[model samples]
Target: AKGRSATIFVYGATGAGKTYTMFGQGEREHQGLIFRAIPEVFDAINAYGEADGHLEVKVSFLEIYNEVVRDLLQENGGGGACRVLEDERRGVVKVANLAEAPVRTPDEAQGYLRAGIRARTVEATAANAQSSRAHAVFTLTVEHVKTQSQGN
Candidate 1:
């Protein structure tokens, strides 16, 4: 995967394994990165720094629910929120500051994820009691010093 920037998109109908697959088991011990990818990325960066070298990583989370944007991190003081903001370039949308949760290990990442899942919004719908009616985006920004460069 040299010179490749990975991008993954998980999508499916209700009751599918989209979330479960991404986040692993919902159990506290087995919780995956589905809801905590940003924190996980930070944890990875920290781990890499400790083992290999230093690097900087930033994360952000956003959600669009019923045509409305909600911040999943700022709500309840990092416990979770539905705050929406306007961006001149990105337009109006909901965004979360994942930098607030700095995870240094996989366990810490899992803890944040468990808290996030508990705080996530769920409503009882006609078809499903707990239905997810929004799109959640977890972004990770990785920066490192390049030892070598390719010339055009």
Candidate 2:
């Protein structure tokens, strides 16, 4: 599974349970995709049996409101808007000056996620009481390095 990549995009109309499906609510057992998926990733990494290798996981949360990109984990809601840029070297889109929190456990990841969610833009509308007025993106990056033997 070298150089593997995956993306989970959640989108729908207001009150369509999009937020619930992504973040869930109430009971801990009713955790959403972000919570559930993170643990699975750790489990998979552990199952890989990389005794001498090192694996690191980082998460970044952001929201796009009125074409402005904001970092959910940063202070004062990213302290302003962030720049969306294209990384020529990686050939991927990225947010400039975005904060990426390193997570070693699912609970750690959840903590950052909770903080970011609190910073997200949500409002009460006539149609949907609690409606998110922006598009949120949660990204998880995994970096792994395999240990090399001296004889190799």
Candidate 3:
């Protein structure tokens, strides 16, 4: 697992700690999961980068509100029709210009993650106020150089 690509999904009820378990414990004051994991992931990447190779990581943060996919990173805010473009060969769907940031250190990644999370949309329904009205997806793609010997 040292040099491999993976996709992970954190799904659960509201306030279920889905993000916490996947990422890590949230800040002591804020108590959110993404806050914890961003730094950890960045630290891992930095450590790996210092060794034999480097990791090129791209993060895309998004939110689906009222059955509409919204770009969390959009400067104008989200609340309109949006489209998902697919890469046939790669078998992936992505939102255009959805806050893709390249981060090297855990601290930098943490900052970006915090900013993106803050930009996410939340709503208050009859059942639950201060609830996330949409599904949030944070995708991190990591690419590392591999040698033929290691491929064996």
Candidate 4:
């Protein structure tokens, strides 16, 4: 495909170092997968050097709790329960009413991720005092905009 996206998902059991490995255990020293991966994605895109237009990077964070999708980046924590609609005309699935933020650097992406994480739902159970009840999904959308003047 001339223009498409690349996606990766991270999953694991509770207390299996999923959150710690994905976002690090707080502190800036131990940067996690999201931090390292976002920068690398930009690096690869920069290296490819689009023959035409420019590139834009945007990120979206969401959590699926009890089968309900919630936008973690929305104002006041989350934007409540959202819907996953399939765009038949576009042939793609979209999350309605989700907050997608444009980021130019990995630092900005990290900031967005941290904010979303803070907004995530955490509860205390008999087994684990601190447990995340929702399944988080972080997406990095890279857009390559080619214009007619660029002579594709």
Candidate 5:
């Protein structure tokens, strides 16, 4: 279980709420999973009040278009120019130049998400001009370290 990891893949048929549910369409009341999950996670973590441990949340956003990956949080186009390689020793897949952002609060996370969303591949559509043309992946890295009171 320690070595195993999980991922939440949000997908559905076209016109379904995949985009709507993931990115929150238009208004805040209709916020999507990505938006809603952030604060809730932080609140739950913070509920421990530093007694459980010190937690840090780092985030990253990426998009896969036509099998090519683009780093959403990266300012330069070079971030997209990555080579995929597998680490046989560690049995892990690696993207050479993808970017990961460190975020403390939900607002900071939201800022990264917004910037990532804006960087996504979108084009004019009959339903919405800003329709996402690629599949986007938002990742959060939660690192926890126990305090002296909790552990030696």
Candidate 6:
């Protein structure tokens, strides 16, 4: 189907290589799933070859800290800037007032990802000094619309 969407959920316990698997060790050539996915998305859109169609891609980063949803891309950590709610109209779970960053390139997407990673909630524990205490969710949305030619 054309207008379909998918989600890749990464979950694991503390120090279980979840972060490493999602976002490699920061090596340029040795990136992770997100880096690979970003380019693939752009490439797929480019391969569409729609002359009269417009495609828009946006990225949003959020984290659930102590069950509180926070927008990670916000300047001041976006604390309490958004809330997870069930949209009865859309019949799906949605985040209200989440900030979205329009990205045109994979680099741009990666940049936002880096910033979000830095804004994650991490705490030092006896087992792991820097343990992520929150669940980070990165969302990429793509919208495509075919434009009508003049007088059509």
Q: Rate the local accuracy (lDDT) of all candidates.
A: 0.55, 0.85, 0.65, 0.84, 0.78, 0.85
What is the per-residue lDDT of model 5 for residues 1-152, given as tens digits with 9 covering 90 to 100? 03234476877655666888888866789888889888987886678555556877888888888888888889853255456789899999977777888888999998899888888887766766666778888988777776676355
Which residue pairs in candidate 2 collide?
none
Candidate 1 local Cα displacement, residue 4, angstroms = 5.3
Q: Pick the candidate with the highest TM-score.
A: 6
34-144: candidate 3 lDDT, tens digit per residue: 565666777676665335545677766778777778776556554354587899999998676466777666566666656667776777766556566677777766777
Model 3 weakest 10-residue run by lDDT: 18-27
> Which candidate do you rate higher for lDDT, 3 or 6?
6
TM-score of 2: 0.87
Q: Give per-model TM-scores.
A: 0.58, 0.87, 0.66, 0.84, 0.79, 0.88
- Model 4, span 33-140: residue lDDT tens: 887798888887778766677888899999999899999999988977999999799899988988899999888988899899999999986756778878889998
Per-residue lDDT value at 152 in model 2:
97
Residue 74, candidate 5: Cα error in Å is 0.6
Candidate 6 per-residue C-alpha lDDT over 97-142 given as tens digits, one digit per residue, 9 for 90 to 100: 8999999998899999999888888999776888888888899999
Q: Which model, 2 or 4, shows the larger lDDT?
A: 2
**What's model 5's lDDT at 33?**
86
79, model 2: CA deviation in Å? 2.4
TM-score comparison, 1 vs 2, better candidate: 2
What candidate 5 gets wrong by more than 4 Å, as runs, is 1-6, 49-53, 76-78, 88-90, 124-129, 146-152
Judged by whole-model lDDT over C-alpha atoms, candidate 3 comes out at 0.65
- Model 3 has a clash total of 0
lDDT of 1 by residue, 58-129 (tens): 444556667755555565623344445568796755443434455445455455555555555677767567
Rank all candidate structures by their lDDT, best first, as comma-separated numbers.
2, 6, 4, 5, 3, 1
Angstrom error of the Cα, residue 138, model 3: value is: 1.3
Whichever of 4 and 5 has more TM-score, that candidate is 4
What's the lDDT for residue 35 in model 6? Answer: 76
